[model samples]
Target: MTAWIILPVSLSTFSITGIWIVYAMAVMNHHVCPVENWVYNDSCSDDTAKHGYPKSCCTLNDVPLISKCGTYPPESCLFSLIGNLGAFMVVLICVLRYSQVLEQSHRSWVNTTALIAGCTNAAGLIIVGNFQVDYAKSLHYIGAGVAFPAGLLFVCLQCVLTYHIAATTLDLWMAHVRVTLSALALISLVFSGIFFIHDSFLLQHLAAVCEWIFVIDILIFYGTFAYEFGGISRDTIVTAIQHASSRACKSPGSSSTSTHLHCNPEGITMI
Candidate 1:
């Protein structure tokens, strides 16, 4: 069985589950108000008199955005840990994807661009996790600024590459799925950005919801990679490593056996 499929699965599952857990922790600790409460209240105000709770419970700063959800003590640590590990997995997956595309098709700059965008997104995620919005507002916004667009670009580029290299009906369908996902992600991002700038509490809440949709859409897109990755075998990774070694050897002219390091491309799958 191919083990590479585990990468995307683990990434999506861990990140999605981890973020929701952070949200729950924030709610339980009164760090943030529950998202459901936004439906009933159109304004961010003192909920103490209404809910018969303390004045510190569910204030304006406590809106349940993902960043806000993880802004507090214990959950913030988990958030940072998740971001670091998720970023590592994202880098590994993007590298494997680039190598796979290189082996399966004529090497193109699009694949390389996508790899860069993925890495940038991962870097932004790291910053977002480590720099809490409440504590480090500027750094957190900078990270978000980098992450959102880069992630959208990566998914869109992957959609194009998927169509370009498609060999079967399933590949075409997967490409279509990716396109739809990227489109929705773009729309959600735009709405989130526009609403986020508004001063109204309701608009800001909607913006937060849109942000959630955008993030979850990106995670789902990553999960789709598992379908293609299922075709990969141990030999695929070995060949990619050998090919890199061969290129390194050829560049420096240090070894005569560089020519013999050429791997059989036949082992690479179209998917």
Candidate 2:
């Protein structure tokens, strides 16, 4: 079997490719201009949809956000599919990461908090995917609001954890990489938000660019986990579960008589 390292790689690959595919579809259908033109054009008009096949077009006054790229037909279905599957992958990766960290380093509040933030980020992704920005503006914004900040927090926490538990030179180097990526992600996120709210078309375009940069940065950070995750195997998950079950069996409320049924002599639990 392949190492669990594939999980993070798959998540990053599919998500980045999928979003770009949606953007391509939008461009092909005349729903939005090519990203290069959209960002650099001084003037844009929403009239393409009238001359073309699409029902809507992203004009200069309305910069195409990533979410906006999938608001229309065809691409919308792909977008939702990517969002839901990506969210599932994110959750899985988060769980595996938490388990790995707990085993390598002693459990701490940082690890626990990272897990929570990751889950929140995943939930936000699901919402963003299912709710198209044009159709459900409020809900879409809510999801973005939750996902972006939570994602930043998750990466920052993971960087700190990497530095805290780093033992080898490779681990220390990984910490440095993560710290740099986290800083860039933070800067992109802040500018994306700040520029998005402005009235100027160029500023809005810049915001869209920043949003893409932020997302790409996050995906790259996730990809970095593949190196560490290369060590994870089926036994890793089994061991983590066994540890949890044994801890539960030893809780104060559990009786010795029930303990034998819940846990084996080797401390492995049947359940």
Candidate 3:
């Protein structure tokens, strides 16, 4: 069987790395402002002077300036593509793993809710990546609007689910850590949103910083899934093999004694 624990860890790592790599590429190409500049713009142009603050301040809007990193076209396509696709895959796998965990723990409601939130987040990421801020402002903002809150909610639900399972199925300390990270992610997202609504340059910069914090926290939160992936993968594989064997033994024309040896009284495979 494959070492499934590597799946989530790989996806999370790729998502985080993709974002930073895109940011770096944008900065190198002068498509976006350097981190030190603090200014947020599609081109990092000094056009924010009219707002009374130096061009060093970041821009405040419903969508983050990072989404604009790919506005420069062909060269930046990889940036957006990697970020969007990586994030989508990460969330998709995360949702599946969480659902399995919840199902095993007998928390069906939480599993459903978390799956919905994770799917929403994944969809939002697709929108955000496809619609560059400079190309389609409305769509970009809409995507950002959906992604931010939904992502936070996903983390929150997962945190609750983790807490519930910690006593019986998971490590207590890991659950606590996940809960704390989820809380911090939500708080940072809220502050980021609040600051984005203000006109002050400093507030906007702070908002950008908070947004980064939220993203980082989310990546870390997802990384926690690494602990259970292997067990889940093993169980799933074993279950499949057992089911297959039971079917083979019960096939038509098979001897009753043979079927009795392979099948259980409950009509279920005992793996």
Candidate lDDT scores, in order, read 0.84, 0.84, 0.69
Model 1 C-alpha lDDT per residue in residues 139-254, reported as the tens digit of each score: 99999999899999999999999999899999999999999999999999999999999867788888889999999999999999998898876656665666665466567555
Off by over 4 Å in 3: 38-64, 168-170, 234-271
Q: Is candidate 2 or candidate 3 better by TM-score?
A: 2
- Candidate 1, residue 210: CA error in Å? 0.4
Q: Lowest lDDT 10-mer window, candidate 1?
A: 262-271
| Model 2: per-residue Cα lDDT over 1-271, one tens digit each | 4568788999899999999999888878766666676434444354543423453444553356799888888999999999899989989988888888877875688998999999999999999999999899999999999999999999999999999889899999999999999999999999999998887767888888999999989988988889789887665676568667767879998888998776773645333
lDDT of 3 by residue, 1-271 (tens): 3576777787778877777777676655545555556545443355642322333434443223466556565535875676577666766575556545644664356667777787787788788888777778899889889888887888888777776666554477877888899889989988988997887766776776788889878877877888766566545544434544666877889998887776664545343
Residue 157, candidate 3: Cα error in Å is 1.0
Supply the TM-score for candidate 3: 0.74
After TM-score superposition, the amount by which residue 136's alpha carbon in candidate 1 deviates from its true location, in angstroms, is 0.9
As a whole number from 0 to 100, the lDDT of residue 21 in candidate 3 is: 77
Candidate 1 has a TM-score of 0.84
Of candidate 3, the 10-residue stretch with the lowest lDDT total is: 49-58
Clashing pairs in 2: none
